[model samples]
Target: MISKTTIDQVYETARLEEVIGDFVQLKKSGSNFKGLSPFSDERTPSFMVSPVKQIWKDFSSGKGGNVVAFLMEHEHFTYPEAIRYLAKKYNIEIEETEQSDEQKEQANERESMYLVSEYARKYFSEILWESEPGKAIGLTYFKERGFTDDTIRKFGLGYGLDQWDAFTQTALDKGYQLEFLEKTGLTIVKEQTTGEPRKFDRFKGRVLFPIHSMSGRVLGFGGRILTNDKKAAKYLNSPESEIYHKSKVLYGIYFAKQAIAKEDNCYLVEGYTDVIQMYQRGVENVVASSGTALTPEQIRLINRLTKNITVLFDGDAAGLRASLRGIDLILEQGMNVKVCTFPEGEDPDSFSKNNSYEDLVLYLDENAKDFIQFKTSLLAQEAANDPIKRADTVRDIVNSISKIPDRIKKEIYIQECAKIMEISEEVLYDTLAQIDKKGFAEASKKIKQEQKAFEVVKNDQVVEKVDVQYELERKIIEMLLLYGNLKQEFEDLVLKENEEGELVLEPEKIEAKVYEKVYLDLQEDEIELTNTQFRTIYYKLIEDLNEREEFTVNTFIANLNQEMVSEVSSILMEEERYVLHDWERKEIYPKEKGQGIAQLVGETILTLRCNLIKTRIQKLQKGTEGNNGDNSEVLEEIVNYLQLNKLLNAKLNRVLS
Candidate 1:
């Protein structure tokens, strides 16, 4: 367990925007920062970070919390892991108490797998630097490839020993479970006829590359075998597990995300070394697909950082034509993509190694071509001197163009295609329209199928009515969080019998803290928050506010359980979503929170009272209907509740029918 003092230091030192900005590209919007939602595939900026409150909310996915919660959600880190990550990032030394065996065993399966993979990374890295065979084989290979010692260590490059059980035996001896080893694909287990399980290392005799999530947790490993074994594959990757998904993991994202955001463009490459070489050579915003075809999940990872991708390709690779199809996927995500190829005899790995950093940078800049220009020129050469093939080439380019989501961008590309193909804009536009029509028809079919399935489920469910009381209770909590510590003047309504013998509400002005006024009003009415979550949070919030000399939303939220934290954040951030739209600029000003804090508090209390009184009146009327006699007192009570409800509603400016 982490010490309380260390945890407090982390919370105080780590800035929410600075931590989240490493994962998502954040741009300033008013007092907060806005970025694409990392939790969902969103083109619009719905993820918000408030440096003032030290909290973030992703409106698209409805996930919001403090910095710690964001790490737990985004990186799948446990609470301790998140704390430790922050401690590392902010240079805070963690003071810890030793864990008991029971405590160690209590870790979940996913965490166990992560621990095992991380151990494997460390073990292999040690072997590379310390072991004789590792130094001779793996270290030599990397050095020969022109990687410096700092680059190798920075990426956690390692090598598994040639012996089959070297890693498996060591992990077992260290008390790590064989179950986790097998799950993480570090040790392959086989059962023998004699009932003993056979276990061996998965990446034996191979140099290892650790694949990390955006937050630098070791998700899995990609291994390349050094020996000339014709029977074995040259490269192997860790099998998918609960913690690691290859399609969603990029090779160097942990290292490249900051640079990618800073540069506003990502360099996409084909393999691990291509990324390392380019990133090592001062081109920092580079990542690789790790020899896999591009996936939407992978693209979405990059989409969080930037909207532009530049794909680097080897000149002599035979799959150049096949790779062009992947560029369309990038375009479909509404991202700008450019293609750059090295000179005839080289790939990114060899080219970066051979050339100086300045030359490599210059070469990329000079050769990079827009997808439209590159595809048209490459295909046009093949279709030259044949009108039939020429027409097919034009259609192919237009098909790629049809994938763009933006209407203006689509029109612009169409015009550009017309110029490049020496064809009329009308013809290309007609092709784009035909493609879109077919696509829309297919999409409509899928939606109808999905709707039918949804209707079946929907029919079996009960539709819940809106809970007005819950909303009122939630509003009170919001007000408490927003203005609990501020002193304000309030209009307290006193219900008294006027001279005409009718109960009437008289406004009395009073000065008090907002929380004090709210507390007094609710206490006088004997109104309790009926919702269990609100009821639990209300007393705790009130206690914290009264005892502390100051109130901070982030600190208060940090002390609550996740469910209550979510509720408080949902209440507080409900108004933040609308901040994106500047209504004042359009001559439509919305009520500011600070300007109406006192009225808002008074109105929320009034609405809750009205709702409660209305409920009481209904119960009385129901009781009168059931009973045949002695209903006069209940009738009088209902009438009194009705009068009180009317007055409360009047104060709230709500018409009662």
Candidate 2:
């Protein structure tokens, strides 16, 4: 356990923007910082960081909390681990209490895998620097590639020994479990016929690159073999596992995310070496596809930072053609795509190794072509002197243009493409329309096929039957979180029976704190929230409000467990997301919720009571049919309930049934 004092100090010292900006590209938005949500695939910026409150919220994913919570959600770190990360970031010393045996035994599976992967990074790094063959082979290979000592250490480049079981034995000896070792692909385990199981190092005799998640946790490793052996593969990557999914993981992303956002662009390359080399040369906003086909997940990762992508291609025609498939995916994401080809004889790795940073950047600026131009030029060369190939290339380019979500961008590309191919504008537009029509028909068919499956899934997995009740209960919690201690004049509205018992609106204002008003109103109705968690939070807030002069959202959140924290955050942030105060800037003035806080709070409680009354009325109706005694009182009770329900509907501004 970390000391409470240490945790407090870390939280106090950690700035929300500083912590999250390390992984996300946060830009100034009025009083807060905004960026594309790291938690979801979004084109518009919705992730918000509030330095004043020391909390961040993803309007897209509806995840929000203090700085520590952000790490816990994004890095998948345990609570203590998030605190430790913050402490390390701010250079604070941490004092931890010893873990109990039961606590150690209860360590989670995902966290255990993280522990093993992190341990392996350190272990491999140690071997690369201190061991004989590692120093001579691994360290030597990195240095020979023109990587400086700082560069090697910064990226955590390491080496696996040639010995069959070097890494596996070391990890096992260190008390790391064999199950995790095998799962992480750090150890290759095979069953022997009669003896103990045989195991070996997976990356033996290879230099290593530790691929990191956005929060800098070790997810997996990429190893490059240095031998000239004809039988061996040149590079091997960690197989898919819990923490590592290569399609979603960009090499050097943890290091380059800030730069990518700052530069307003991300440079996509094919190899880890290319990213590392170029980044070291001061072009910091660079990432590699890691030789895999580029995936939309990878594109979304970059989209969180910026919408501009420049793909760097080597001069080789065959590899370049193979890589072109990825650019359409980038375009489909609505990102600006620019392609840069190095000199015919050189790749980014080789070129950056020799050229000055200034020269390399200048070359890129001068040579980079828009994807449409690059595709047209490259394909036009291939389609030379063949009418069928020319027609096919035109269709292929049109297909890519159709993939673009922005119709204006598609038309712009179409115009540029027609000029390049010497074709009329009408022909290109006709081709695009055909492709879109075909795509829509296929998509509609797929949606129809899956509509039944979609119906079974609940909204946020909460049942629809009582969703409105849940909303009202959750609204009470939101009111407490946002304005619990603030005192304001709450309008008390009533309908008067003037002589004939006809309704007349009468209004008065009563000054009270928000929580006091909510508590008293619920107390008067003798009603409680139906949901267990909401009820717990409701009582906890009431208790805290009574016990203290003021209630702070952060302090209240800190007292809850992880589950309640997420629930409470969702309620608070979802309210903020729906808030229309900021929409006025766009000429969309909306009625502010704060304008009628009293009505809002009062109506929520009234609605809950109204639901209960309706339930009771149904019971009375059923009882009247079954009762063998006088049913006058039961029918009278039902009539009175109906009248009370009418008054509640009137108070709620709903039309009476």
Pick the lDDT winner. Answer: 1
Per-model TM-score versus the true fold: 0.97, 0.89
Across 353-445, the per-residue lDDT of candidate 2 in tens digits comes to 999999999998999999999998999999999999999999999998988888889889999999999999999999998999999999999
Location of the lowest summed lDDT over 10 successive residues in candidate 1: 452-461
Question: All models: lDDT?
Answer: 0.90, 0.86
Off by over 4 Å in 2: 24-69, 445-468, 490-510, 577-587, 606-611, 632-657
User: How many clashes show up in model 1?
Assistant: 0
**How many clashing pairs in candidate 2?**
0
TM-score of 2: 0.89
lDDT of 1 at 507: 89
Query: Model 1 lDDT vs. the true structure?
Result: 0.90
Model 2 clash pairs?
none
Model 1, runs deviating above 4 Å:
452-464, 581-587
Tens-place lDDT digits, model 1, residues 1-657:
898899888988999999999999898988889999999887878888889988888889898889889898999888899999999999999999889899887899999998999999999999999999999999999999999999999999999999989999999999999999999999999999997899989999999999999999899999999989999899999999999899898999999999999999999998999999988899999999999999999999999999999999899857888999889999988899999988898999999988899999899899999999999998999899999999999999999989988999889989998999899999888888899999999999999999888546656788799999989888888888888999998888887999999888998999999889888888987888999999988888899889998888877887887777767777877777767665667887677678778888887787777778878888878877857788888888888788788777877777877
